[model samples]
Target: MATVTYAFLCSGVGLALCERLLSQDTERLRLCLACRNMHRAQAARSALLAAHPTAQVDLLQMDTSSIFSVIRAAQEVRLRYDRLDYLYLNAGIMPNPQFDMKAFFKGLFSSNVITMFATAEGILTQRDGVTPDGLGEIFATNLFGHFLLVRELEPMLCHAGRTSQLIWTSSSNAQRSAFSLEDIQHQTGTQPYSSSKYASDLLSLALNTHYNPQGLYSSVICPGFVMTNLTYSILPSFPAFLWTLLMPLFWLIRMFTNTFTLTPFNGAEALFWLFKQKPESLDPYAKYHSLTSGLGNNYTQPRKMDIDLGTSESLYEKLLQLESEVRRKVEEKKKEAQHAHRHLAGSVSS
Candidate 1:
């Protein structure tokens, strides 16, 4: 039997998925945690190995926000693996999130309270900025970095006889209105997190349209309202005790809507479900959601996303053009650094 390889782009629920995968098929599967933090990655590897002694879990240092880091990580993967069975594009950020407490309080009395709580739709916004690459940090980390990684690993993912899966950790908050075709980076938006996720939804459809023939399949999933580090960052001003106090309220809200998949394990249900499925069996137009009942039972459901083929194709083309421009800039920076190094060396020798 051929060994299956899985690469996850973040920790949190990605680590949970790793545990699920290894518990069932430790001997036959190789798991790689591609994370920006080597320390956390090493610790996660240790914990997984401690639980499943013989499982193969490797670590790749990758900062998805940095173009050079993503490129280097992809190169490393190419050298280490001949085939990749699954790639979880789960790394994301909602830096400096601003929660509208007034809106939150007002929404509690409204008919759409369930929707507001489940998706944080009207009550959440974020402060976003640019990366060193001049790409919006949220856009770079959440979507384009994963896109570039897929492009770099096309050899393994698009192997002729075999198939590969790309599972994106999208969200219930990914509103169609948040994203703009002209400003793909969400430069002027307060909801960069939502915009980035919406972009991922569009990109997944485009990937299916473009690479399904090449044996590469892409699907997007929402982890519901998971209480990971990202969620904690939403209210940085709040004390730890305040969140603890709000847990009961959250539980009550979960009664009405199953989108409050609060734990990483629960959030990973949809992702883990997809692992058992044949990529060809999935609905490319549907966004699979990980849901949990008030009683805490977990399940997966698919909802059709508000997207169009025309828009998806247009985004794909724009990404291709941006990729070309980014590569040129990276090459020019490399050459300039080399030239400066050579000049310094010559002067020192003289």
Candidate 2:
């Protein structure tokens, strides 16, 4: 029997994974639902317990946008649990998403939206927002925060197996082209969400290089474009609702086409598919699993690009530097906190 923890970001997706894992066997998997919101985390916990009354479910606040939040969450987990098997970096956001109208309509006719998003992908976000950390929200949630979380929780994650796996919930929408080397946050007129996702893809690949030998295995998952709540942000709310009504048909088209995977269950195809294997055996070619029409319903298709070992390595090094700097900040704050506590205690005694 194997003990596993499904560490995920999104409450909905995390719950979905928990439901599937729990349905199998109660004693096999331990679930820790880490979300940005505590109220939502409590609600998710209640729902999970309602279904599986005896499930080992715990809730912790893991806001990836802030390094402090990540460090705090890691500390909380250390206080409670011992070893962690799976670290699913499944929390990401396309904040203030805006569809490229020109590309959408054009892609609809050419049926290229599938390949376009998969291979030479491009993202259009004509909107603006900022995170509490002051970095671009999309970048912070999608890449940087996860980066910090991985750094903070390295000790637990490395305890999974002789070869512990770091699973990154990446996407086919990740574009090597849209991502700029200089501006990772997409400060200029670029799609920051896509850039950040691309950065993560590169970062994941990079992690495998440096960490795989250290008994840590890293793999990135392309959860083909599932009709997640995250995607609804791009369109007018009503229109998006109408569009979802036709989503099944679009999925049907993808059944035969190898380029697609439909539904959250299906979108999770790659994540589930990869779970059956050892991390050391992962395809360096970046094994992509998809569903095709002639295939009935299977996740065994491959597209080009999204596997740059070099870029991945570069991103990994960059994150290491960021982690060092962030940890220093945490230690300084801890020292200040201790100083304040000492002063307060002295005043109390006086």
Candidate 3:
């Protein structure tokens, strides 16, 4: 409807946006959703059409763990849109997630310790020594994959007459102490998930530094806590039927902190705000924390948190280098693929 190109990455919470946008009087926005799986994307599409039958929306396959996938995804985006209005990088994971029940029970007795260590906000653990692109699993999927997408799509981003923004889906549980430059990959006994989110924070900050001058802006937001596939990973392996027993309490807590495992809808608050705000108008160095005290009402607010600007800047430089190297590799591979095709064609002609 609107010419605004909104790429809702992972769009797990896109239903709300679709409803709100479709209700608007103007048909001035078109959507491109980047998702890891096709089925989920199609289901989302079906739901959207049920409400807004004429919505111009398409889906593209993207697995952030794969550099090649990011490249291909960007290529697809470039093919469709000459200018991008907003990019909400809402896709994230806590692979192999495990909760420390001791910590959870302890927090339960205290004031809604919203960011307690053992909640759905648990750090990441990947399958040992595996990545779609052969990089650190967490780093590759959670950070580098999005990083490469922005790089490859820079042209669509920096179009002369349009406003563009980049959004990073961050979390309130992020701690400065959890991240270390020496162990950026989190391979040295640190929580890989935390380090990766920290990297997302840094990358968003870095993006403002590098590209804002060229008319692009980036900001990061933390969705307080949400109950999604990513959260169920930490729900103790109790019988599913038995856990359904907690539904009443879950809804009660969702009233207090909104992290009680009903659903992750509140987590999209920061994301929703950034969607409507100017990127340069936000603090790149801040962790835009989302707070939801759902006390019979959903209250979503953003407050700045402590961050290291020095580390954020340094990480930016490293990412630039990585982006450059990846581009080189992609170029080399393109040449090889082209050459192989030409040789095969020559043999057939002979």
Candidate 4:
């Protein structure tokens, strides 16, 4: 039997979903840990090997936030493997996150408390910035960069006889109202994280529609309220001990809604579940959520996403346009640099 190849983009050390996924069946799986930080990637690879010495784990360096880095990574992937079975678009960011204590208190007494916690509707906002590529950092890191990677690796992903799956780590916080086609990058918004996630859902649906005939499948998942580095940044003012003390309160909230899958292992439930499923058997319109019950049992549930085919297609087109613009700019810069180098060399010789 051919071994299954799984490439995870931006695998977090210790709290990564890839670690749990690899632990399940390391011998049969060829794991690729694609991350920006070589130090963290090496650490993650070591930890995985330590637990399962026989596991086949490889590393690729790529910062999903940078367009140039993504291009180089795609080239490396093409050279390394002929075909990729699963591409876990799991890397994401929420820069300068600020929790709304006032809104949290008000919502506690309101009927929307559960909704607020589950979806983080009015209780969370993030201050986003621009990337070196001149795109919104959150949008680029969370959505467009992955989109570009998928586009670049289309040959491997869309095989004639076999199917490849793109599993995106989206969120329950992805609200329809947060996304705007007019401002797709959320350049002027305080909630770029939410906006970008919503865009992922739409883009997934679009990918299925466009590539299903060619055997490429796309699906999105909500790793429900996982307490990773991203979550820790939200309430940085709260000491680690204080956050640990609030575990009971969070557990109590879980009884009302099971979306609070706090640990990365629990949050990865849907991602692992998707691995065992047939891509064609999945629902494109649903956002698969990783839920942990009050009893601490973890399971994957699919909820209908608040996106339509029309909107998804529109977003897909917008992404294509942005991709073209960025590529063009990159080429122009390369040419300018080459010209400047030649001029300097000529002057030096003279």
Candidate 5:
């Protein structure tokens, strides 16, 4: 049997999907936790090992928000593994989120209440910043960094006879109108999170178009509205105690819409489900969603995405261009630092 290697980006402690995925078949998986913080990654590894003493779990230091970090991490991964079977692009961020209480209250009384709750449309906005890579933080963390990593690992992912899977954690909040090919980074938008996710959905389709022949497959999944750290950050003013108190109300909302998969384990259903599927048999145009019924049963379902081949291909080209530019900038910065260091050394010697 081929040793199935699974590398998860940004999945640490409290990440329900990582825990659930490991619980299913710890003995079968060769799991690698790719995270920005080594301390947290160590903790996550220890926890997993505690649960399954014989499970193979490793760690890689990677910060998806930083291009330099991603590049270095990808190099390390290439050194460690001969072939990668599954790459989970699960690292994401929604910075400086602001919730619109007025809109939420008004929508509660409107006919579109269910829609509002399901998608959180018009109910949330976020302040985005540029990363050191000169890319939008949301765009870098949610999509571009993962894109770069995939490109770097193409050699391992695309082999002669074996197939590799790229699964992205996308969201229902991904809106068609929010993303623009010209502003692929969403630099000027308050909905950077939404725009970034929409771009991922588009990029996944494009990846399938370009890499499928090379034995690499790409797919997107929505984990629904799970009350993870990302979700809690939306309403930072709401104390953890208050959120705990509101659990009953959230459950009531869950009854109205199955998208209210309030827990991380439930939110990870689609990701775990996709692990069992044949990549060729899956629909490239569909977004797999983790849903929960009123009785709290978890299941995965596929919903047709709003993306088309033309837009996907267009976005893919734009990303490749950006990738080239970013790499050039990184190289130039390295050269400048080297020149400065040499100048200082010469002056000191004189």
Candidate 6:
């Protein structure tokens, strides 16, 4: 049997998926946890090894918000593995979240109450910043960095005969209104998180169109309302006890909509389900959702996304152009650093 290698860019749901995969079969499976924090990654690896002592779990230090970090990590992956079966783009951020209490209260009495609770659609917005790469922090961390990583790992992913999968952990909050083609990086938006996620949805479709022929398949999944690090940040002021107190209300809300897959394990349902499926057999146009019923049953469901081929293609071209520009900038910066180092060395010698 061939060894299947899985690389994950998330911690919570990704770890849940890792546990599921190991539980299913530890033999001939290589799992790599690519994370920004080495300490946390090491802890996750230790925990996984504790559960399944014989499992192959490796860690790669990667900050998806940084361009050079992603490139270097991709290079390391190429050095370590000849074949990568799955790449999970699950790292994301929602910085400085500002909850609209008025809207939340109004929605409670309105017909959109379920939608508000299910998606957090009109109730939340975020303040975004720029990364050192001159890209929006949320955009870089959530979408572009993953895009660059995939581009770098194209050789391993698009290999002949065998098929590989690109599974993106998108969101139900990914609104079509939030994303703007003109401002792809979402520079002028308070909802950068939504825009970034929406971009991922579009990019997945575009990737499918381009890479499917090369035995590479791409799909998007919504891990609806999972209480991960990202969710915790939304209401940073709320204590853990307060959140615990709201459990009953949350459960009551879940009775109305199955989108409240609150736990990380439950949220990973769709991602884990996709793993057992044949890449070619999946629908490229649909966004798979992780759903948990009121009776606590977890299942995967596919929902048609509000996306068009023309827009997806356009986004693809824009990303290609942006990638080229970013690459050129990186090269120029490298040369400048080299010149600075040489100048300092000459001064010391003199």
- Top candidate (lDDT): 6
The residue-by-residue lDDT of candidate 4 on 181-203, one tens digit each, is 99999987789999999999999
Give the higher-TM-score candidate: 5 or 6.
6
Which of the two candidates, 1 or 6, achieves a greater lDDT against the reference? 6
Candidate with better TM-score, 3 vs 5: 5
Model 1 RMSD vs true structure: 1.1
Predicted structure 5: lDDT: 0.89
Model 4 clash number: 0
Instruction: Tell me the tens digit of each residue's lDDT in model 5 across 262-325.
Output: 8877888898899899998999999999999999999999999999999999999999999999
Q: Candidate 6: where are CA atoms >4 Å away?
A: none
> Per-prediction TM-score, please?
0.98, 0.86, 0.86, 0.96, 0.96, 0.98
Candidate lDDT values, in order: 0.92, 0.70, 0.70, 0.88, 0.89, 0.93
lDDT of 3 by residue, 246-336 (tens): 5665666656564432344555656666666766677776666445555544444556656666788888888778778877887898999
After superposition, candidate 2 runs with Cα above 4 Å error: 1-3, 111-113, 116-123, 126-128, 159-161, 290-296, 300-305, 331-350
RMSD of each candidate relative to the true structure: 1.1, 3.1, 3.1, 1.5, 1.6, 1.0
| Stretches of model 1 off by over 4 angstroms after superposition | none
- Cα lDDT, model 2, residue 152: 71
Candidate 2, lDDT over the whole model: 0.70
Worst 10-residue lDDT window for candidate 1 reads: 2-11
Model 3 residue pairs with clashes: 1-27, 1-28, 1-29, 2-27, 2-28, 2-29, 3-28, 170-222
Q: Write the per-residue lDDT of candidate 1 for residues 207-292, one digit (tens) a residue.
A: 99989999999999999888888888888888999999989998988888899998999999999999999999999999999999
Q: Write the per-residue lDDT of candidate 6 for residues 110-209, one digit (tens) a residue.
A: 9998898878888999888989888999999999999999999999999888899999999999999999999999898788998999999999999999
